[model samples]
Target: MAKINWKPGNMLYPLPAVLVSCGNNKDNYNIITIAWTGTICTNPPMTYISVRPNRYSYNIIKETKEFVINLTCENLVKAVDYCGVKSGKDINKFSEMNLTIEKATKIDAPLIAESPVNIECIVKDIVKLGSHDMFIAEVVAVNADDQYIDKNNKFHLDKSNPICYSHGTYFSLGKKLGTFGYSVAKKPKKKYRKK
Candidate 1:
């Protein structure tokens, strides 16, 4: 095998492209598309989202200490891209993107109704990293589109065609290969046919 050396950088790609909505009031509500976010803990249901201090929504989130992470899908690619590039300080992102603002149950931040899933989060801590500040939050509530929920209550997230960010490009999630523990599961046994 051959390898090439490279400088230290953020090489982690294929991250969830989520629209983080923030603000305490309707006048200041805004959305900022973020790829730098993920679950930090499972038991406590914690997550984190990194944002640049210069971003318009950054201050809103910091001051309010609350936000909603709206999972993006193929249908929201255009709006996601626009929210990422445009400044909320100059314009209302929800209105500009023509996205519906659904009321969050646990938080004041509005959820993107078009999104398949909306995770309501309350900031627990703030870590100032270089370039971006990380907001570590506890998941207060989650809202999934009823259409994607099965009768068994299992969420078909993949069916929503979730989108991700890689480097500077966006991509849709591919086909599922296997479920967790598939490698170690016991195989089915066959019985001999009766003569």
Candidate 2:
């Protein structure tokens, strides 16, 4: 089949749509929905989120050098889209979205109580890249809701039904294939019982 030529653009789709919570103390807390976020390093657990300077939460995170990457679930899709399109300056997102702010362990920024996982972060560096600035942060702490944990203590993040952003649309993650190292992993050997 022949394909039509399309203009060169950012066609990289299906990125985690997370609500990054920022600011210190109760009075200054804010949230900014971000799709331009990804794990940068595995050794020290580092991640980056790119935000435009005009975003209200951008300045707060820049000035404070800290934020929480709250993983969005299926239920959080509405708030995630709302937080991205609406400015924190014009509205109290927590109140408007009916989201609860819970106390974080290591940072002053509040965690989204509704989120199954919250990754507390401290900004290590900022790179200015035209329309957006990338915040490189060290993951300080990760909090997960106990409900998603199984009796075996296996955290079933997949059951949370995480949401992702792609080409201006939000989508829920679907299905699971093999896990890490499965391709090269050795198969279990079977033991023959004495007949």
Best candidate according to lDDT: 1
Q: Give me the overall lDDT of model 1.
A: 0.95
Clash pairs, candidate 1, are none
Error of 2 at 79 (Å): 0.5
Give per-residue CA lDDT, model 2, range 1-195, as digits (tens).
999899987778878899999999776789999999999999899999999998899889999999999999999999999999999988889999999999999989999999999999999999999999999999999999999999998999988999899888889888788899999999999999999
Q: Model 1, 1-195: lDDT tens per residue?
A: 999999998888889899999997899999999999999999899999999999889999999999999999999999999999999889988888899989999999999999999999999999999899999999999999999989998889999999999989999988889999999999889988999
Provide the TM-score for each candidate, comma-separated: 0.97, 0.92
Question: Which regions of candidate 1 deviate over 4 angstroms?
Answer: none
Candidate 2 Cα RMSD after full superposition onto the native fold (Å):
1.9
Error of 2 at 148 (Å): 1.2
* Model 1: how far residue 67 lies from native, Å: 0.4
Model 1 residue 112 CA deviation (Å) reads: 0.5
Model 2, runs deviating above 4 Å: 3-5, 187-195
Look at candidate 1 and tell me the lDDT of residue 22: 93
